[model samples]
Target: MFSFYNGFKKFAFAMDPETAHHQSINLLKRFPLVLSEVFRNENLGGRYGVQVGNLHWDFPIGLAAGLDKNAEAIDFFTRINFGAVEVGTVTPLAQEGNPRPRLFRYVEEESLRNMMGFNNEGAEAVRTNIIDSNRNGKVLGVNLGKNKLTPQENAKDDYHTLYGTFAPLADYLVINLSSPNTPGLRDLQQKDTLLELLSELDALRLAFPKPLYLKIAPDLSFEDIPDIVDVVKEKKLEGIIATNTTIMPERGAGGISGRLLTEKAALVRNKVLECVRETPEIQVIGVGGVSTFNELWDFWKAGGKAMQLYTSFIYKGPKVLDEIKHGIDSVMAQNDLKSVQEILDNINHISKP
Candidate 1:
């Protein structure tokens, strides 16, 4: 499989990244189970399962949003063995995002910079895609965002509409206010604004409830993390996804992800975890720059549960999942732990990666 992907990567990487991404999505949209089966991890079973809010993931790592912005290829992603699949940054209407050269890759660094300003096929089409998808019992989350044209005051309305549309369809839902490409999107991350937006959703949530999470940025002030945690607590959210990609101006425009985001993301994750330490119900879904089993180990040590990866999956492919699964097995064997729950139960006592 590794060799196959390497050969495939050589071909895929030769093309423009966005072009290659679209081609991959187009192929998956054909719904070829044979191709999906080739990448399936047969060993992923109940033992690897972990709980994230009301939803249960077959494994820890999930495909983050952006890869399938339209949820056009759910069958391939679910079957490929990610514990969960999240789609969108979807808005109420379709968008073309930024112009050409929006996706830039840092090959040697295993990083990516995207200025893709939440471009997606809008709610109705995406809702149709979600209805048509085969989740394979793995969790599916819809990451929602306001339309690029939506005024900041009307942002809560967009979210309210999105939550109502997706709540019944997705196993979980994420309110994505942290993507850097959209103008003034990150401003919603401020404590007062964050609280206001979520508070406005209270009625809609009561009408059609789902496991909800907030995806924040790594560039936030560390001092403000607890206040964000407070907002989560105040609004009765399921958790926070610590981090969407981060801004790196020196690298030029757009948000930086992958290896370029690891350290800052880790710091933010740790800070959020610390703030939520006393409130175990408010879990943190780790994302951004997390690529290895050792990093997963650190996350567990700090009380994190499920994680999501996009950039690493791009650079290393399915083998990365195998590596983490093996790393878990090694720790389980060394500590006589039979399940991921057991490993988490005795995370400190288990062998580090």
Candidate 2:
């Protein structure tokens, strides 16, 4: 499998990154059944189940948002052994995103930079597509974003609209306000702005309840976390996803993800975990920079309920998902633990001192 992925990477990387991504998505959409069986982990069930909110994940590793922006290929990915598949950053209206050359690869660094600007087939189309597939038993999520043309002041409307449409269909919903690609999007993460947005959205959510998580940027200061946590507590939101990507202006435009984000992502995740230490109901979905077993363990140690991957999936291939699950199993066995919750329990106990 590794050799096959190596060859596949060589071929895929030869083309532009976005083109390669679209090609891969096309292939999955084309041969969903065949590839699903080829990549499916037979032992995933029972061996590594983790519960997040009301959902039971086959494993803790999930595909992050932005990969299947339109939810066009959920059938293919959900069968590929991911415990969950988050689709979108989808806006209310279809968008073309930024112009060409929006994706760049830092080959030697195993990092990616994108100014994609939340391109998708719009909320209605994405919701309709996923509904058509019945999600194939996938633990699905929708990452909602405001349209680029929409002013920041009215951003909550887009989020509310998406939640109303997809909340009933998805297992969970993510409020994506941190993508560096979208201008003024991250501003939504500011304490005052975020508080107002989430408070209003939380009210509407009461009518059609679902687990809603906020995805924040890695560039936020440690001081910025508690205020966000305050809102999570006030709104009674499910959790926070730390993070989106780091803003690296020196590298030119766009946010840099993957290896470059490992440290910062962990830092922000730990910070959020610390702030929410007393409120266990508010969890943290540790994302960014998770490519290896040790990093996964560290994220668990940081009190993350789950983890998501994107750049690693791009650079390493589908096998990493199974690798993470098996690695977690090994850790559990060595520690005399029975489940992901047990591992978290031990980590919490140790952190107390």
Candidate 3:
């Protein structure tokens, strides 16, 4: 199956990246039941099921946002064994994302590059999809952002509106303030701006509570991490998704992905953990370049309570989940670690200051 899939991937690579993604998603959607059964039997559940506020996730390995912008294939993705599926960077209003050829493949680097500017069918449409996805038991997270034409100053209102509409349907909500594709989105990550946005979001969550996680960028400097930690603590946010794609690549304009981001992501995860050491209650979802069991283990070692994969799924195929879960279980057993949580605790004890 994997060989056939790889062949398909190779064939897809011959075409434009964006087109290939659409083709793949359409194909997956066509066989949702079969895919789901296969993934479930694989037992690719994460080391532990984690609870974030009101949401209980069966695993740490989740599908990140951008894969299903419109929430069109939740049934298909859930069937493939993700612990959770974060759909959309959906805005208050729907709009075309970016010009043609917005997505590219860097095959040599084993990476994908895209400036897919928050393209989606809008919050209302996505909300309906989420509400309709009740058949799938997998956890759902909605990643929210402002529309492209919306001014930066009005961003908060857009997010607020989305939260109001989608919060009821989502197990978790992600504040997507880091996508380079959206102009001025990263500006919201600035200290004062972040505080304001989070404060408003925190207020919203209080009125209508849901697990809220902030999705950050891997391009941020080590110094920027503490500011984010402070805001999370101050607002009493549920958790943090330690990275979105990075724009600081030496090569190009689009955000980089895959193996190249592994070490940097680990560093950021370590920094975030360090910043929140005294407050171990705050969860961190590590993402960025997690392609192997070892890299995932390294993320856990670095204090990530949960993790996510994107480019890896693109490169390694669906079986990657089973491979990672089985490999980690073997390592944990060999090391006399009784559970994933126990292993994480041990790693924290050794690594924490």
Q: Name the best candidate (by lDDT).
A: 1
Better of 1 and 2 by TM-score: 1
TM of each candidate vs. truth = 0.98, 0.95, 0.92
Report the alpha-carbon TM-score of model 1 versus the true structure: 0.98
lDDT of each: 0.89, 0.85, 0.79
Which residue pairs of candidate 3 clash? 36-79
Q: Model 3, residue 268: displacement in angstroms?
A: 1.4
Question: In model 3, how large is the Cα lDDT of residue 166?
Answer: 86
| Cα misplacement distance, residue 282 of candidate 1 (Å) | 0.5
Candidates 2 and 3 compared by lDDT, better number: 2
lDDT of 1 by residue, 1-353 (tens): 88777877898899999999999789888854876766656577678889887678889889998999999999888887799999998999898898888999999999999998888889999999989988887899999999989999999999999999999999889999899999999999999999899999998899888889999999999888888999999999999999889988999899999999999999999999999999999979999887888788889998998899999988988888888888888888888889998998997776753
* Top-down TM-score ranking: 1, 2, 3
lDDT tens digits, residue span 233-330, model 2: 88888899989989899998998999999999988898998898898888788899888777777877766767898999998888787677767778
